[model samples]
Every structure is written in structure tokens, then in C-alpha cells.
Target: MGAAVAAQAKQGGAEVLWCPEGRSTETRKRAIAAGFSEVSDIAEMARRCDVIMAICPPANAESVAGLVSAEGFRGIYVDANAVSPATMASIKAFAFRDADLLVDGSVVGSPPSTSKTTRLYLSGSGEAVAVVAGLFSGTAVDARILNGGIGKASALKLSYSSYQKASRVLAAVAHGLARDWGVQDELIDIAGGRSTSYLAEPTYIPKVAARAWRWAPEMREAAAAVGELGFPDELAEATAAVMERWAEAKDQSLGISEALELLRTDGPQTAPGPSAE
Candidate 1:
């Protein structure tokens, strides 16, 4: 995502500077090779850059924000990471440590790149929204500045993730059932014809399965939020349960390969092939 963001900015004639954590990582390597000036520390990046876009995982986003605050870096701080509303609120509290304008943001779909399609959902102070939108203006990204406070943007993300997670659970569970009943492929064909699974299967299942471990906790969080809000969370709960199960099977629990193998309806001899003569 950081690479995509940097590429987008560079494409729009902006000089890209990077300050990635640790000595070496994929992003840091790519940034250096891409001719971006790499800053030695977060404090330096915060002091120099007009915007500090936090693109880390939700679990670590707030910590990074706190680091920025500790550095006394002042600028527009954009949280573009996926996190719960409560988590966002906590991060917001830490972000205001240095009196910086904190803008809550959620990147819907994928990052801005040649082959990716997604929207940037921004919500915060009106002026901060404008500033964020302006930064992305003329870029290929579809930036939508929603009207709400800090947590609103993350709420949108949670809602969307819930829907996606539910669909994934249904696919894997149904696929498993069909295999057990000895009618897996046939059922898959029939179901695909009449459901969104047909389209989503090729689009999201593989992606989700690969990183299922990282997402199970977030799905559980969403389920709890739904219950707390007095909404019917049967789907979310079911999804979370399925994900948790997938996250704990075999030594390779929470891995994509394991889930893919577990969910496979077609055996080695039954998989698609050329017709017999």
C-alpha cells in the first residue's frame, strides 16, 4: 500500500520521501531503489513531511501515531489503516498529542495502483478533509470525503469487511459441505449460477484464504460491535466462527494453503481436465 501510495504521488508530480520503521523491509528497499529520500527516523519524517499517512496494520497504527506525537511532529496525520472505531478513537487521542490535525481515513477496496480499484474514505474536520482530498486530486484514486468524525471512517470499513467476511465464510463452509456429501462440484456449479459467490469466488476467496489468520480477529471485533449496536449479527458471528476455525487447524493453521486445501471440493482425480476420448 505504501508503495502504491508513493507511486500515485510520484505519478502526480510529487517528490516522494519515505521514513519506514526498522532498517530493512520491502517498502524501505523499494523506496530507496525508487530514488525516494529515506529519512533516518519517524521524527525526521514527521518534521519534514506536510502529511504523515499511517499505512501500517490496525494493530500497530496507534503506536506509530504515538511515536509521531512523541516526536512533536506537526502536520496532517491520516490514518489509512483498517481498525475498529474504538481503536481509532484511542489512536485519535494519541494523535492529538502534538496538536496535529488528525484525519480519519479508510481505504475501501484496494490501494491506488494500475491494477487496483478502491476508494479513499476520509472523515474528520472539514478543512482536513479538504486538505486530504486536495492531495489526491488529479490522481487516479477515487477519494470520497465522508461527513463524520474520527470513528466514522473506520465504521464504514468495519461494515464493509463484515459483509466480505460473511461471504467468504459461506463459500468455504458450503464448499466443505458439498465435498462431504459427495456432491461438492455439482453444488458449487449450481450455487455459483444463482449467487454472488460465483463472482466473489474468483475475486476474493483466494486473497482472503491466504491472509485469513490476520483477519479473524478483526471479523470477531466486527461481530461484537454489531451485537453491541443491537443489530442482528448472526452473519458476522458465523463468519467469525468459521474464520476462527480456519485459523486453528493443523500446524499450518491460519494459513491460506491450509484453508484452500480444506475448502477444496475437487480431488486430484476430479479436478477440471480435458475430456476423456
Candidate 2:
């Protein structure tokens, strides 16, 4: 979302600067080209920019926030990662020392570009909302401010992802079972007749599949957070476990690209033939 926000901020005549994670090609290149100064210091970026948006994974956001805090950086820290509400609260506590904390939870329907569409759900202190509300308005991006503190926005994001994740898991499980029964195509057709048409090769499926492989660690964090809230995250935990299995089975690395390629090229052990009457 740094790219989306930076591109939008540029359109709005806001000068942009960026501090990227050390290991990310996606963030490093995207931030520089969008006119953000490629500064290595998180403190410097936080000290200079009006807002510091943390778009890392939920598992990583706190470390990013800690880095900013360690630098004694001062600015609005907007965390737009996909995390549980409880985790957001912990980050909020960490942010209270020097920065104006805004806990943001964003869901991207597509890539972060002029050609792509995305959504940002903003929350946290009301004052933080007031300061950054105009940044998202009247642009190619769609950002809505939500009520509550810290975790509400993150909760919303996790819930949204959970639904999508659940669908993919169901698809995987059902597909596996159908192949075992020798009725994969017929089962898929029958399910399509009853379920939403979008389920038939969902547009989000590939992205989901790709992401599935690498989400185990993050999902573990999410599961822990969810469990802390007294909610049973069996589905999320199971999804993560299955993703690990898929990754190991393919002999590919834990990344979206590898997983996508593996799923595309790999064959099922149990092939579906004609259905038994």
C-alpha cells in the first residue's frame, strides 16, 4: 500500500519519502520509483514524514514499530498490516511512547497501482484519523475511517481474509476428496450449481494459492492472537498446516510464486475418472 499511497500522494502534490525493509524487492523498487527517498533509517523516515505507514505482515509489524520507537522517531505511525485486534493493541502500546499511533487494517482487492484497486480501513485515536483522512480521499484509492481503537481495524482485515482463506481451503479439501471419489469434474459442477458462481475458478484463487505456501508463520501468529481472544482458530491453524504440507510436497521454497508454479505443474495422486452410479 506504500506504493498506492505514495502514487496517490504524488497526485495530490504531497512529497513522499520511503524507508523499505532490507529484504524486499517489491517494496525497495516500488518505493524509490514512486519518488520516495530510499532512506535506510526508519527513524529518519519517521522523523521526516508526516506519517509512517507500516505495511509489513502482522508478525513483522511490531518489529518495524519497535525499530521506529528505538530510533526515537516521532510521527503518526499507521500500521496497515493484516493482524488480529489483540495484536494491534500490543502494537498500540509500543507506539504510545513517541508517535501518534494510528492502527490501520487494509485489504487490497488488487495490486497497488493506477491500474489496480485497493481498500484501506483506518482506525485508532480519533486525532490520528483527522490528520490523515484527506490522504485517502478523492484519489484512486478508497480508504474509510472506522470506529474503535487499535485492534478493530485489524480485526476487520483478519475477518475478511479468513473468509477468503476458508473458501480456498474448502476448495482444496473438496477438490482432493472429489479426486479420491473419481468424480472431480462432476463434483465441481454440482458444487457450482449450488454455490456462488465465483467459486468456479475464483479470480482470487491463484493469489490465494500462491500466498498459501508462505503464510504458515504469520498464520501461527494470527492463530495465537485469535486464541488469546478466546476464539478457536482451528480453520486458520488447519489452513496454515495444509499450506505447509503443500509447500513440502512440491519441493519448492516457501513463497507465493513457487507455490503457484507448483500447483500449476503438479499432478494429483488420485485422478478423477468417470463417476460411479
Candidate 3:
């Protein structure tokens, strides 16, 4: 995702710089392929860039912001991670105290490889948000400013992903239960004859497992967001557990049937939930 964003920004006539201090070899390769110049240090990159966009895992959003803040960065800070509104507020309050402007940003849809497919939502001071949106102008990314203060875009992202990911979990649970009851075929037939085509097969299981490690934190964030809105967050919290179990199968190259078998036999063990603070 960072590579895609850098590629678009570079194509749109921006000099993209990245700090690949402890990133993997694959990340370095992708960053280079995206035409991003590697700065030796984060502080140097922070000093050179007009806008510092942190596109990372939800768990590291606050730390990334803190790193830039420690560098005494005063440019526009764009937090483009999947985090809850409360986390965003905390980041704004502490990690971005020195930032000239804080742009609460959230990315919805896949990475922007083609035009008009992915949307980058921004909410904050209107002028700062507009400036951040302008960086993606004439590029493949579709950037838009949401109406509200900081955390609005993050709230939207958490709410949307809560339903999107939890529904996938529900599908997996239903399929697993049907298979356990020795009525898998009947369940599939019923689902296939209905309006939902994707649920007919357990294909989404492996697909979700392939990225479950990443989705685990996202589900936890969604749980916190739902709890903040005065709703029971157990569904999302349970989904996070499901995702953690699947994380072990990420590299197993399991097919739909195999994934279902794994889920049924090796379900998630009791584990502590991710920290939203």
C-alpha cells in the first residue's frame, strides 16, 4: 500500500522519500520500484518532505506519529492507518503536538493501482485536508475531504471495516458449523441458491487467512470503536480471535476445504485481545 501511494505521488510530480531503516528486503525492493528515494534517517525524511504520510499497521500508527514528532517535524502529518477514533485522538493529542497540521486520513478499498477505484478520505482543518488531497491530484488515487474535525475519517473507516470484516467471520463460522454437522453440501446449496454468491464456497477462508495477521489488529480496533459507540463489541472481539487462529495458516497454501478443516480442528486458543490504547 505504501508503495502504491508513493508510485501515485511520484507520477503526480512529487518527490517521494522513504526511510527504510528496518524494513524487509521486499519492502526496500518495492519502495525502489515505486521510485522512492531512501533516506538514511527518519529525521532527514521528515525534514525534507512537506507532508509525512504514515501508512502502516493499525498497531503502529501512534508510534509512527510519535517518531515524526520526536524529529521536531512541523509539516502536515497524515495518519493513514486503520485505527479507532479514540486512537486517532490520542495520536493527535500527543504524537502530533509539533505538527503544523494534522490530517486525519483513512484509506478505503484496495491500494490505488488504477484511477478512481480506491478512495483516500481526509478530515481535519479544511485547508490542511485540501492540501493533502491536492497531492494526489491527477493521480490514480481518489482523495476526498470529509466534513468534520479530526477522527471523522478514522471513525468512518473503523465502522465500515467492522461490518465488512465481521461479516466474513460470520460466513466462516457458518460454514465451519455446517461442515461439523455433516450438512456442508446442503448449506452450500442453500447459500448458492440465494443472493449471496461469495458465501457459497469457503474460498474466502484462505484469502482471509493469508492476511489474518494484519486483520487481527484491525478487528480489535473495530471492536474498540464499536464499544465507544455504546454497542457490544464481542462480535468484533471474537472475530479478532478467529483471525489470529487463521494467521498460522497464512503460509500453509491451504485450499477452501483444507482451510475449513484447519479451522474446525485447530480453532483459535484463548488469547489476550490486542491493546487499543
Candidate 4:
């Protein structure tokens, strides 16, 4: 995602910089491939860049923001991680003390590519939001500005992802249950008759298994979002728990049965037992 955004900004004469120190080999390779000018560390990157974007897992968003804040980064800070609005709000504790502007951002869709484009939802001060939007102008990333202030983009991202992520996980569970009954194929056939049945897709379970690790934390963040809005968070919580069962198969090249084999029947009971009075 960082590579995609940097490449796009460079199309408009933006000089992209990356710090390779302490980065993983895969990350360093990608940075080199993207041709980013190397900086020594976060402090140097902070001093040299006009805008710094944080594209990371929800769990690391606050910490990453702190690193930049500690550097006294006086530029635009775009937080585009999947996190709850509350998490985002708390980051402002350290994010905006020295930073000129901290923009809440969320990405929707696949990475911007020739065949498929993605949306970058941004919300914050109008001026800062517009600047971030212009950075991707005429690029594959469609940066849309939201009217609300900080945390709005995060809220929207979690709200949309909660349904999309949790529904797919639930669909995979449904398929698992059907398989146990020797009716999985029949279930797929039943779903095939419906135009809106994404669950009907044959590759859904494998796809979930490969990405379960990454999605698990995001689903927990989604649950936080749901709970913040006074909603029952059990669905999001269950989705995270289910995804964790497939954590071992993350990004592995495996057949469907191999992926599904890790899912155990020892999960919490589906229905509550009678309470002792």
C-alpha cells in the first residue's frame, strides 16, 4: 500500500522517501523496487518528508503515531489503519501535539491497479484533507474527503469492514457446518441460485484461511467500533475468534481441506446453557 501510494504521488512529481533501517528484507526489497530515496530512520524521514502516511495493522497504529510524534514531525500525518474511532481519538493524545495536522484516513477496495481502483477516505481539517486528496489526484487511488472531523474515516472503515469481514467469516463457518453434514456441495448449490450470494463462491474458505491472521485483529477492532455505538458486539467478537482458529494457515499455500482442518469444534457453545438461579 505504501508502494502504491508513493508510486502514484511520484507521477505528479512528488519525491518519495523511505527509511530502510530495521525494516524486514521483504519490506526493503519492495522499497528498493519502488525506488524510494532512502532515509536513515524515522527521525530522518520525519525531518525530510512533508507528509508521512501510516499504513499498518490496527494494533500498531497508536504506537506508530507516537514514533512520528516523538520526532516532532510537523507535517501531515495520515493514519490509514483499520481501527476503532475510539482508538483513533486516543492517538490524538500524542499525534497532534507537534504535528501540523493529523488526518484520519481509511482505504476501501484492493490496491490501486490497472484493472481495479481503490478509494481512500479521508477526514479531518478541510485544508489538510484536501492536500492529502490532491496527492493522489488523477491516480488510481480515489481520495474522497468526508465532512466530519478526525475519527470519522476510521469509524466508516470499521463500520463497512465489520459487515464485509464478519459476514464472509460467518459464511465460511456455514460452509464448514454443511461439510460436517455431508451437504456442503448442496449448500453451495442452494446459494448459487441467489444473485447476492457471495458465500456461494467456492474459494471463499481458502481465501479466509490465508488472510485470517490479518483479518482477526481488524475484526476485533470492528467489535470495538460496534460496542462504542451501543450495538451487540458478539458477531464481530465471534468472527475474530473464528478467524484466529485459522491463524496457523495464514498466507500458506494449502488446499481447502488443509485450511479447514485447523478449525476445531471446541469453541464456545453456540447457545447458552440455563443459568443457575
> Model 4 compared with the native: what TM-score?
0.70
In order, the Cα lDDT scores of the candidates are 0.69, 0.65, 0.80, 0.80
**What is the lDDT for 236 in model 4?**
72
lDDT of 3 by residue, 109-139 (tens): 8888864467899988777888889989988
Pick the TM-score winner.
4
Model 2 has how many clashing residue pairs? 0
lDDT of 2 by residue, 95-140 (tens): 5542245546565566456677577777766778666666766677
Model 4, residue 154: distance off in Å is 0.4
- The CA-based lDDT of model 3 is what? 0.80
Q: Rank the candidates by TM-score, best first.
A: 4, 3, 1, 2
Task: TM-score each candidate.
Answer: 0.67, 0.65, 0.68, 0.70
Q: Write the per-residue lDDT of candidate 4 for residues 1-277, one digit (tens) a residue.
A: 7677677777656788888766799988877887778888999999998888888878989999999988998999999999887787788765774323888899988877777788999988888888989998988888998876777888889978987887776676556556666889999999888786444564678888899999999989867765665555677788799899987787987776666667866632343322211
Q: Mind giving the per-residue lDDT tens digits that candidate 1 earns over 61-121?
A: 8788888888886788888888987787787665673223888888877667677756888
Backbone collision tally, model 4: 0
Candidate 1: RMSD over Cα atoms?
16.7
